[model samples]
Target: EPEVTQTPSHQVTQMGQEVILRCVPISNHLYFYWYRQILGQKVEFLVSFYNNEISEKSEIFDDQFSVERPDGSNFTLKIRSTKLEDSAMYFCASTKTGNIGYTFGSGTRLTVV
Candidate 1:
């Protein structure tokens, strides 16, 4: 079985600072996504990428947020300016198809102070 991998399992940053979360999806997968969950809240989708372009994005993915596949295998999320509200567990996921099954990375816990 394949899985998504995220780095720096945890991160602490000052408010207004920039942060980049990294992930590597299953090599064979075609769809990739970034999702976040504020502590005690439901998971929220941030953005979806396919074929080197954004396929969909949530309102949460505003001007401050961006996603990139700098290399064919590494998918990354950049937060231009962090906010206390942005402190959460960010997950990376991928699937061969947009079906119900998706492999999600353990998550990167970002804490904005």
Candidate 2:
């Protein structure tokens, strides 16, 4: 019955600007993740966090991207500089364990102009 929550459902930013997307996963979950889907493309994993550290990250999570649980409650993704290619729907997800299903947030639509 628990759920993940994402804020600012949509965001528009200028290219080269910075943006931070926020999410609060199910309180008791142990693993949290950030994924993104470029319009009409498959969803891609960006990073996975556990125990306050990054457990896994995809190639897409380059030097410009970072994730942190600044308050041990809200998980955030920061893009150092926005790019037109970065426009996509970002999703936050969490699960009690890897074998279990994940609860995903509605998604944050980021648009770079």
Candidate 3:
């Protein structure tokens, strides 16, 4: 079966630096989403994109964060300014239907020092 893939499984950056997390979502899917898990915290939705525009984004998706579909299969998240609190496992997910369960990439671990 096809699966989502994320590059640089782990990333370490200094606070205030910019970071880009890359993900290649599953082909043939129409909806994509980004979520983050802060250590022991619950998975929080950052943003959902469809039809090349943002469908929904939580409060956490502030000016510091942005999502883009630079290519057919690639979805990327750019953090303009990293913070120590930004450390988390960022997961990329996709689904054929927005309401259905999603298939998530292993995740990219961001560690802002």
- Give TM-scores for every candidate, taking all chains together and pairing residue i with residue i: 0.97, 0.97, 0.98
* Residue-wise C-alpha lDDT for candidate 1, range 5-65, written one tens digit per residue: 9998999999999999999999989899999999999999999999999999999999999
- Flag clash pairs in model 3: none
**Positional deviation of residue 71's Cα in model 2 after best superposition, in angstroms:** 0.7
lDDT of each: 0.96, 0.95, 0.95
Model 3 residue 15 CA deviation (Å) reads 0.5
Worst 10 residues of 3 by lDDT: 93-102
Steric collisions counted per model: 0, 0, 0
lDDT of 2 at 101: 87
The runs of at least 3 residues in candidate 3 whose Cα sits more than 4 Å from the true structure, single-residue gaps closed, are none
What digit string (tens of lDDT, one per residue) describes model 3 on residues 1-113? 99999987999999999999999998999999999999999999999999999999999999999999997889999999999999999999999889697999999999999
The TM-score of candidate 3 is: 0.98
State in Å the error of residue 62, model 2. 0.2
